[model samples]
Target: MRLSRSLAFAALFLLSLTTASVAGPGRITLPAEVTATGQVIRLGDIAVLEGPATAALGDLTLGPAPAAGESRTLEGARVLDALRRAGADLAAITYTIPPVIRVRRASQEVSEAAVRQILEGFLAEALGAGAADAELKSVELPGPIRIPAGPYTARVVPPADRPLLGRVRLGLEFTVEDRPVKSVWVTADIGVYGPVVVATRAVARGDTLAAADLTTERRDLSQTGRSVLTDTVDAAGRIARAPLVPYTPVRRDQLVLPADIHRGDVVLLVAERGRLRITAPGEAREDGTRGQQVHVLNRLSRKDLVGHVVDGSTVAVDF
Candidate 1:
């Protein structure tokens, strides 16, 4: 008997729940202006529905919102169309009508981390091929970067513009899908760096380079062109063509090979043809490095002959 009574009570409880679900909520009241909490704005979310309206549209489906920071008005013909779609008998009901119903998108709060991520990616792209290994020095923004938060994306405004060089103001456009929402301007301190050879101390022109005079260091790649050597071996023993400052990048154009033959020095002039080799004492007319062509005066013949400097002692002359 107790079991039968409990079963009967359970059946009654289920019936009430079904009846309430079928009836839905009481008449919903819609304000003159409704702020949308999500992507879609529905009648159930924005309006107050009474028995008839509630029965007509248990849930009214409106289209998507206009934009993230914008609003859309639905009334008159639009409202009538929605009612028809909801299977409501518009002609039979004489309900109070308002001038218009406005649906607004709620302002979304943007986090600082989100904006920083965008700026970082933007600066990385500016590095081009070096982006993967490029190290950022510092990034600065003129003002707070904030935008209406939702499904959105960020990109360089012009797209075809040059990369951010040194410190400059940059423009980035934020979009929702394909629609543009806002543009943000910020200052960027971008730098791309790599290893380069730098002088350790001030050295005068014509001074020969030594290993202790140079050290490898990281510098902006933009300033370090192909003329800059990364290794001290290439720079060592080379004569300085210009005054090198301490801690400054050493460029290839700033150094030259030491001269092997000095001008006005006496050197042996050699002439050879297969096994026919002859030598004569001569004076160098101009300073020359090994393998360089220079004028040699034959001391006995008193004639200037062009020959290649072989070393500190010899200059090879033909004929």
Candidate 2:
């Protein structure tokens, strides 16, 4: 009698599990659904899509990590449009595959259905409902999932579960390998990027000019000259003190003389064959001999330096 009762209970448990499709720890719904015509795209958390990933994007790149409330996903416009724009050309890509990062929350607090939606939004791998022909294990979740979510990571869950619904923000940073890639989805993002001024010159190897890297049209260098066209990096874009450009890719910064420089005014000077020069403050006697020293200034660098006069303000020093 005990054995027969046990068997009956086992069958009941199995039936219950089948009824509650999205069940247990991660509550993953087996056989993820996909559409017949459309496929899904999963984006990474805050990321920068660059390297050879560019070329086609020109100056445009993705942000640090993919975001949740961003306009690109559900609308299917921003990222999808770019990839669709690329078509089949290997050089052209409109989408980027993100590393699947999973998220989990407390179970009773979240429901089965809610968990599924978050997973769908987070993974976004399956294609549209087909003749239900193809199946791909595109999404990877945290392994050996337990029952009842509690800080679960990289796992999928039911759709209705709310408190248990968490996000695994994916970040799509890729290093391309020289494989014979058939279909490529290059990472592309459409939104605000930089005025993210990066230094194109290094301080070493004779390219230490910060003035050219950062542009500022003070007083009279504007097209209309009404307001100074100050194109300087605001805090975030500015590189602090140290140089950050690699040697092979550096474009040297130039030292241009201000057209309106006045005599007896303190100025910066740079000579092809000598130390940077700066003029001394306060005027000397009308006699050319009175405290006569040639003060050359390096206008590119806003530093004050003095040098011995070769003749008047023309000074010589080795670079």
Candidate 3:
């Protein structure tokens, strides 16, 4: 009976040793404070793991990391619960240290000057070939921005509805690892220089513009409220609708097309009904450009009519 008891006791001791070897001498130590550089906090980030079984648990994700320039605290109990959920053998592992852990995410600041430089480059690219003569009058930023410590890309989004010249507002977007983190508004004043037509001499309202009457000059097109004529050919032979002073920019709206048909001139009145056409001699009562409607008197019928001016001497009428 004594020999059988000894054999059973020895067997039990050997089994215990085998079980300990399988579980491993696992140990975990938590620090009071930690810093994280990634987007998420991992077990290894806040805790030191010893032994084979516990070392593997270090890769387990704890939770989302705090935003840059910010910190968050985690409790010991919560961490233990997470470990337990991850199927960690609690009874076989030993833990040492803090009841709570504080974690801070590493960050960096984007300076105002850097932002201005970025916007300048963006503006230059937006202007394309015209950027060579473009001037940046002013740049306004919303101040510095803080973000996670890592490489990032910045994109300047211009307003799609209009051009980038004059006082313009743009959106500045920062993306890290292909994920958008923040956005800001930036404003700038831009001036684009280009040639514009200017009146060389005082031009009356009814005076026709001639090559000698207008000249080209370089000016800031942004300040011009109306679209200015760029070439003398666009203004030549066109009648002025408003009085233009010398050395002043000539705008497209200030000019009108020369009259094609004048009052009291004889015109060929044409009428079309189905495929049949009729023609009569008529007298125009009002000056009009081609395609303009004018009052006319048909000589054959001696009746008043309104017709579209086709040319300097022809008008079309509907019967």
Candidate 4:
């Protein structure tokens, strides 16, 4: 029975030694070159980890990652020191590391064409309803942008308190994983087109505008003033206040409503006081359209008075 007990104790001791040897000191093997996508480099990112304690040591942060499209070199001695500082058990780890390791941040190039497409989408949303006829004449980017390799989003910011028309600068912001990584400005030329009334033929002053004399055309509204006429019907039958050149946009200030009453014309002057009406002969002293007040010579009273033009031949005067 004593020999049997001794033999059992020896078996237990041998089993324990084998198990300890199998689970001993983790292995850390640094590669010659590594590509990192994250902003910070971790021990597991640049090195191949092995053994039981690797799970605890893999989370140790070494340092910041290289910039996008950039590379950094780290010495093996420095890496070991960093691991030690981060509470990694160096005594319980074995290393198969190179003297120096090259770490590059993986990146992608954003082409100019892609950037323009992004800007176009943003401009369309920014212009709202007016975007239907809006166009991007040209887009000038600073240059190609390099971003970290991952899913990313781009945001375009338009100039504040400024019209979207004409030359303007737009801001571009690039974000990777919800973190802003780069900012840049791009110049753009924008144009908004709309139909406008233009003189098809030269129109002399005081000549009534006809449909044959005017036509509607698509033009860049930004170059034209806001008061430009859009419909030929609005300008037709209206007298030209100034000579209009051919192919020029018709403005509101260039046309006037045809006069209903002209100067030196004989008209009926009417005076009303609470439905007590009186009519007398009068002469218009000036030309006036409907709803316009004009000077009238009252023949019976032999006096000049201001009266509202009611029609071609009738003028209403206050008693």
Ranking by TM-score: 3, 4, 1, 2
- List model 4 lDDT by residue over 128-220, tens digit each: 898899988888888778989888899998888888887889998999999898888999888889999999888899899887888999999
Model 3 CA lDDT for position 65: 89
- What residue runs in model 4 are displaced by over 4 Å at the alpha carbon? 1-25, 73-75, 96-102, 204-212, 222-228, 232-243, 251-319
Name the lDDT of candidate 1.
0.75
Worst 10 residues of 4 by lDDT: 18-27
Error of 4 at 310 (Å): 17
Count of backbone collisions within predicted model 1:
7
Off by over 4 Å in 2: 1-139, 144-195, 204-211, 214-232, 235-240, 246-319
Give the TM-score (vs. native) of candidate 3: 0.75
Q: How well does candidate 4 match the true structure in TM-score terms?
A: 0.64
Provide the clashing-pair count of each candidate structure: 7, 60, 0, 0
TM-score of each: 0.53, 0.16, 0.75, 0.64
Q: For model 1, which pairs clash?
A: 27-49, 27-50, 28-48, 28-49, 29-48, 30-47, 30-48
Assess each prediction's global lDDT (C-alpha) against the native: 0.75, 0.31, 0.88, 0.88
- Candidate 4 residue-wise lDDT at 265: 96
Backbone clashes in model 4, listed as residue pairs: none
Error of 1 at 255 (Å): 3.7
Question: lDDT by residue for model 3 over 146-250, one digit each (tens)?
Answer: 888889889999999978788889898988878787888988888888888999999999999989998999988888754888889999999999999998889
